[model samples]
Target: MSTTLSPLIDLQLKGFKVYEKNLTLQEAERPLLAAQIFSRRDYYKVLLLESKCVLHYAHQRLELDGGQYLFFTNPHIPYSLELRTDRLHAYACLFTEEFVAAARSESLHQSPLFRIGSTPLFKLPASQADYVRGIFHKMLAEQQGDYPFKGDLIRTYVQLLIHEALHLQPADPVVQPNNAATRLTSLFLELLERLFPIELPTQQLTLKTPQDFADRLAVHVNHLNKAVKQVTGKPTSAHIAGRILDEAKALLQHTDWSVASIATCLGFEYPTYFNNFFKKHTGVTPLSLRRKD
Candidate 1:
């Protein structure tokens, strides 16, 4: 079943928050940890968990039992957690890509923990678990403190957690059926959705074709086409065109960017190409769409 896990918003800052699993719940309230089935969120997450549970992450599954586990998830991938027993204890840190951009680390999305197709779960040794727990404790304290530089301190802790996970070997996922098509389709969609909202005029879409996505996902174009068609009932090119069309309409209606700027941002070599594509898909020019709004 599909579910949406809402973020615990931080009023002081829009993008980052930390949670102690038990403290957030009332005496009569149960944790909603299991409500994350196949859900995607618009932030990055690092979780330190002490529970017996099953994690359905993208196309992979991991069964964790009474061990200290560290999990990393990004906005693009979909994941879920199923508790095997009710005794749950965990600490989670959630932040957006913008929140940690100020850190002196490499791009968080390119990190092994958050990269697509990389393993996200790790089983930590008892001693390492204690060290990881200490970082989370510091994050919790800094999040509530009145220090003006607390955001910077929290970002440093987030980097520490990521660096720690980088040194650990990721846990192996449980073996499953040969559902390559489903797995590839899920990954394709995730990659497609990752380049969205077009927050700035200078921001550009990178993977705009089936071959581009295929190369990024490390699959042949034919295989990607077959898999996307088999799973989504549409060709890979159709999906790409559909998403571009949607973004074109949204940009035209919502922003004051010139048609040429929008065209370049969407990866068109020329505004004429964008014009033809938009009219072909929507039967109206980009300017016409804007005028209607």
Candidate 2:
């Protein structure tokens, strides 16, 4: 994230930045969370970054070999990483949901990038790295010109990267689509889908509580739990907690915010409480996860 101001986003949102003007900056962010970024309070961001070091997020450490690829999450998530070696290579960029805002179309969905449903992070094989690099390299090169559509061009490059990365992933496992065991589980997911700004695996927030989601759905908490479990083979709280953690992972990897800020966002009034809760569930403290990154 860069401290200097830019015209890329509206000023009303409190955001953060970090950037690289030269080579040594890379060494500065050892055990770095994210390279540099700006996040608006109004909307979340989708970031792209490069790294040669291993990263931890979603309870896993991504091997950062040149052929491997991972995602830079928004604040609605949690993520972390630690350098496996002092020498690593990476580049990243941030764009909000509004940044990629476009009308729905086959091209929008069929595009390799936007087609991803839930798991936003993807790993690319050696065969596809060059293809992915070519698109980002072009995006990086575009800054050299005074093109009137530089922003648009960069956005296009990002979209292409998503599509290409998706194209190269292994075939997904068979999970039946919308085949819940009961009507309530379906309703729960429906309500969840409508709840925008969910805890991204890259974020932290209080929306994790069952009551918060229940109030939105206007259903009794126990009823909501039973309904979701009967239909999905998992408790409703499990689903909620899972969503929170997934988003937590995303935020940890993609943003530079401290654990306290992240805890507050995820709904804990106190950061320490949030820390204990997360550690209890994930077996790792938030800062521990961040330090790993």
Candidate 3:
């Protein structure tokens, strides 16, 4: 069954305050939030559960029965839960992308930490659970203090947890090396798709080039370009231009915004630039496209 998790605002109102920086750790409490459909939050989520439950993420589901376990959810994926046990005792820790920025790691989408489109649940043995619980306790204890380095310490603890997870089930280096190229390409396309539909007349895409995405993914431009071409049979820049042109056509046809306004929204420095770009890509100018529409 689909369930809607609480929003960040609702969670904050219910005592999930930011303990330090962009991180917040919330203990399960009374009058539990209702289970609905999928819930999307703009931060990373880690839940250490003490009860059995079924979690639905994207097209897949995981059934956990008793024992301590760790489940991870990144900002990109929306998930829901169905509590199999009446008593739901869990500790949820949330942190934004910027909070853990200092740690140089793979993009969550391509990282083995959570895997894509699925909620990763790692069953903790009794001994391991005790150790993991201690980490959570330390975070909780640190919450009571005003130490300036509190955020840094918590980020380190989170990193510890990630390392532990990796240790438990390390990715196969041999297989991954072969698959990494395709995976990176796919992840890039997914990231590109996220900034779409131009919901408003003012929404501008910050990632306008292959280099921007390469920087974000922590990969060199050549590697990213090669992977994209190998997988999609097109150059990296072509995909970007195609998407921008698609967005431009959609905007011109649907919105009454002027050409200049549309140009700015599509990341063009000037209307003349957008006009030339549109013409180069579509054999017609933005105004011409709008007239046809």
Candidate 4:
């Protein structure tokens, strides 16, 4: 099965949580684990290694030695790690986008770590590794505590890790753009993905149509549609509708929010409207999906 943040967290901790792990795996288990492919998800994952390894990230294959940091992984990329040593000691931090949604709202998508073609693998010197490891250690320790503001503290640590990575020179230089179509399509998709997870009931998705995205990207609707269709092999409207449908299904299946509240969160004026939209795309009502689960 593909690994997502929630299920992976369940293997280690509890709800919407963040924690660090120091792993020592046997060489015999490496091949079995390496064969697994992890698709991207709406979460941020960072790995700091105490031993050597090879990282497979989308089209880039990187060899990272001890005291190295693998840059942040976001939903737009697919990645995995392979250990080279019998006992690999590494610190990995994983947290969902919703966990840091409020704090990083304006800048998460713009981070260099998520920029396509930017190198994400960085080798940290011993001193720098200690500094970064200190933050991870604190997060791991505090996760075991019952402090009232523990979650906020962990968020702060996550921010620190990102900032620390930013302080270093990027591993690879940015690639030149291909064409207007690809650039526009990338911008459009980034804009679309930015307003996601719908963390709060009052937080609604404001961009609900191709025109909304076009205006945000400062392009004419027809131009945006052509660019998106050419790159994604789907109509612009279909992309918007599909993303909305995905978030709707996730909320219905994962949360206890009522159908009406979900509809409002998804920018539908009414619950009935969301019902029809969901039914049109998926063969079942939101209520039924939730119940079936």
Candidate number of the best lDDT: 1
Give per-residue CA lDDT, model 3, range 1-293, as digits (tens): 22343343221211121221111123222112322221224456776777777766543467878778887777555455667755666666676666677774666556566555233778999998888878877777655454546677777778877777777774652233258877897688767767665767778888999999999999999999999899768899987887777677656655678999988888999999999988987788788767755
Q: Identify the candidate with maximal TM-score.
A: 1
Q: Which stretches of candidate 3 lie over 4 Å from their true place?
A: 1-40, 105-110, 115-119, 173-293
Better of 2 and 4 by TM-score: 2
> Which scores higher on TM-score, 1 or 4?
1
lDDT of 1 by residue, 189-271 (tens): 76886787576889999888899999999989999999999987989998788777767765675578999999999999999
Question: Which portions of model 1 show Cα errors greater than 4 Å?
Answer: 1-11, 23-40, 170-293
Worst 10 residues of 3 by lDDT: 15-24
Write down the TM-score of every candidate: 0.55, 0.53, 0.50, 0.51
**lDDT by residue for model 2 (53-148), tens:** 555543335666534564645443344455555444555545555555552244433333433233456666656666666665676565544455
RMSD of each: 12.1, 7.8, 13.2, 11.0
Candidates' lDDT values, in order? 0.77, 0.55, 0.67, 0.70
Model 4: residue 258 alpha-carbon error in angstroms: 30
Clashing pairs in 3: 3-36, 3-37, 4-36, 4-37
